[model samples]
Every structure is written in structure tokens, then in C-alpha cells.
Target: MYLKIDERIFRELFHTYYDRLYTGFYKKTGSYEQAQDLTQQTFIKFWRYRDSYNPELSVEIQLFRKGKLVFIDWLRKESKERQMIDSLQQQEKIPVEELSADLKDSLNQAIDQLSPMRKEVFNLAYIEGYSHKEIAEKLNVSVRTVETHVYKSVQQLRKILALIFIMLHL
Candidate 1:
């Protein structure tokens, strides 16, 4: 109930179970990189909640349960993103070249509001079409970090664009 996983034990467990977990995740997700990311997410969850480990329960069960959750969250995020893109497409109706200069300026302002690192990540990801792994390697940060910045930046930009659309319509 209150078992704490010390570094040595954690390392042992990680080494022993990592491949199994990775294989399981890959089987479910059918993507090597996604499986790796989900595996890392599950281990990160385990490390954060190490004190909550119930010794009576099987470690495999607990780890897989966390993996299931991580996968579910990833799915939900992906769904929301897809919906956002669809909604934006429907709302735009106007072609990019036809967008008013005012709208373009507002979009620029929204991007300008992002943190410097996030702005760079967003540009690299969406503008320059860099992959998340490429951005991570270029920035010398983890893939998760690049993913987070890009996700947050897109969400922020969407909100701003929605506001701008409303204002323009009004």
C-alpha cells in the first residue's frame, strides 16, 4: 500500500519488464514510436506514483493498467485534435489566400503570444514541417517536451483563432 520503489529496485524492474511492456504497447498501438512513447509514459506514471504500489497486487498488472490509461489518454487527445482540425476547416470555408490581412495579423499575434521555445517548436513543427523527433533532436530535449509544446501551442492558437473568428463575424 505504501511501498516506495527505490532507484535500485526501480532500475531492476525497468530492465526486467521494459521489453515486455514495449512489446505489449506496440502490439496494441501498431506503431513503434508511439509504443515507445507510451511505454515511457507508463514508466513515468509508475515513478510518480511509486509510493502507491500495492505489494499485494501483481506488478505486471499495475504496470499494464497504467499503460492502458496512458493509451486511452493518448487516444482522447488525438480525437480532440482531429475534431479541432475539422472544425477549423469547416469554419474557414475561406481559402488561405483569400483570408483577410486582418485575420492574418490576428493569427500572427496569437503565435507571438506563445513562449519563445513554444513558438519555435510550433514553427518547426507546423511551418517547416519538422517531425517531433527531429525537433527534439534539434532542441536537445525529449520528444515528450516537443510534443507538449506543440500541443499546447496548437490549443492556444485554436482558442485565439476562434475568438478572432467570432469578432470578425460580429
Candidate 2:
């Protein structure tokens, strides 16, 4: 069935439900700004899909469903962003020259054992402080390739350092 709702009815529906929707979103998100944004987006979706409104269902039910979907998408996006930030933070926490002299010597040895290309990539990124994009441009390779080289270099260094630690302990 074709559903064409009048602007007057739509405005009335929005006015009646706006507060409840905003309050629900605010309770769920715990941020006034995010609640306001999601609430506005919900109404925008309702306005855009007004023609699809099912007369059999209440407008409130349809709006709630759309709002729930918007909230879920926001949550997933937030989770991914949080994970990226945490990963970057962990990488930044790795100390360079602050290690003990022996550990530093071992680390230098570990780095020296990497393949030439991997060693260059690692030095450019960690010591020289070049970003992945900058390293890619400087080395004339894809950013993904630069990242792979750095990743492999780090893995090899970790294994070598682990062995050194074990031998020192023994």
C-alpha cells in the first residue's frame, strides 16, 4: 500500500515523539551531543522514508526501529575507532634508547639481523620517525608494503630479543 503522510501529520508526530527519542538516546549514549545528533538523524530518516510508512504499524514503532539501527551503527564505528586508538597508543609506549645498555645492545643486534629492506623500513619508521605514508613515498613502494616490512621486522626483533632475555636469565 502506498503511504503518503501529510506534512502537518508528520510535524505533529515528530513533536510528540522527539523528546522521548532524545531522552532514550541520551540514556543509551551518555553524551548529550551524540544523543542530539542521533535523534536528529532518526527524524531525517523518517522524513526521507515517509512514503514507506506502514499504516498498520504506529509511527513511534517505526521511528524507534530506525533509531535503534542508527545507534548500533554508531556503536560499531566507535568500537573500531577505539581499537585503532589503543593500538596506536601501545605502539607509542615502546621505548627506544631508554632501555638498559645491555638490552639496547641486544636490540641493536636483533635489528641488524633483519633483511636489508626490512631494516631500512624499521629505522625510517622508529628511529627517523617517518609515517607509513612518508616511508612509502621515500622508498618508492606502496604504503601497505612498507607496513608489511615494518611488521615483519618488528616480529623478528621480538623473537630475537626474547631469546636474548632467556639466555641472560639462564
Candidate 3:
């Protein structure tokens, strides 16, 4: 059954349910910015997929379901990234003091070699302690893109650091 929903009805639905959706996301995420972002994305997805929605289900149900999926995907991605970082840290185990002045310079030089967007994303995520979502919003990019940049930056840094460590030992 194709249910045609007009713009007015869509706007009304958005206004009626947006607060509740935002609240639910806020409780789950514990971050206002992330909650807002999730809420916005939920609505965007709903609008995009409105044609396929089952008329039998309430709008609230559809929105909440999409929101849950978005939240779960976020958690899974974050978990994977966290594990990668943890593994890297354990493997490298480099103390800051152990890095000689030349090694420190080499690290900086390696960072400078990163592409501009990757460097900016890396700095925002690590140096500024911003979450991937936060960096995405600030940079007007997707969360997945931010994740990629961070992952690549870490890989590059690890490689450079490893080489420096080996050179220092020799």
C-alpha cells in the first residue's frame, strides 16, 4: 500500500516527534551533540525512505527503529577503532621520554606528510580530543570518513614511530 505523505504532514511529524527522539538518543549517547546529530540523521533517513515505509507502522516506531540502527552502527564502529588503538598502543609501548629529540622531529615530519584533510581530522580527533562524529560535523564530512582519516593517521604514525624506534636501537 502506497501512502502518500505531503510536506506538511512530514513537517508535522518531525515537530511532534523530534523532541522525544532527541531525548532517547541523548540518554543512550550521553552527549548532546551526538544526540542532536542522530536525531537529525534519523529524520533525514525517514524522509529519504518514506516511500518504502509501511503505512501500518506508526511514524514514531519507524523513526525509533532507524535511530536504534544508527546508534548501534556507531557503537560497533567505535568499538572496532578502540580495539585497533589499544592493540597499537600495546605493540608500540613507546615512552615519550624514550624518543630522542631527533625521533620527535621525525614524528612531526611524518605527521606533516599526511594529506591536508587527514591531518586536520587527525589533529581534531587526537590533539583536540574530539569524537569522530564531532570532527565530522566540524569538517562537514561523514562520520565514516572521519574514522577513515583517523585510522590512516594512526597507521602512518605507528609506521613512522616503529621505524624510528628501530633506528634508535641500532
Count of steric clashes across candidates, in order: 0, 0, 0
Give each model's whole-structure lDDT.
0.82, 0.84, 0.80
Question: Model 2: how far is 167 from its true place, Å?
Answer: 46
Candidate 1 residue lDDT tens string, 76-101: 98788767545543542334456688
lDDT of 2 by residue, 7-85 (tens): 9988998899999999999999787878999999998888888999788887778889989988998899778755653
Candidates sorted on lDDT, descending: 2, 1, 3
Pitting candidate 1 against candidate 2, the one with the higher TM-score is 1
Q: What TM value does model 2 have?
A: 0.54
lDDT of 3: 0.80
Error of 3 at 52 (Å): 0.4
Write down the TM-score of every candidate.
0.61, 0.54, 0.61
Candidate 2 Cα deviation (angstroms), residue 14: 1.4
The residue ranges of model 1 lying beyond 4 angstroms of the native Cα positions read: 96-101, 104-170
After TM-score superposition, what is the CA distance of residue 47 in candidate 1 from its true location, in Å? 1.1
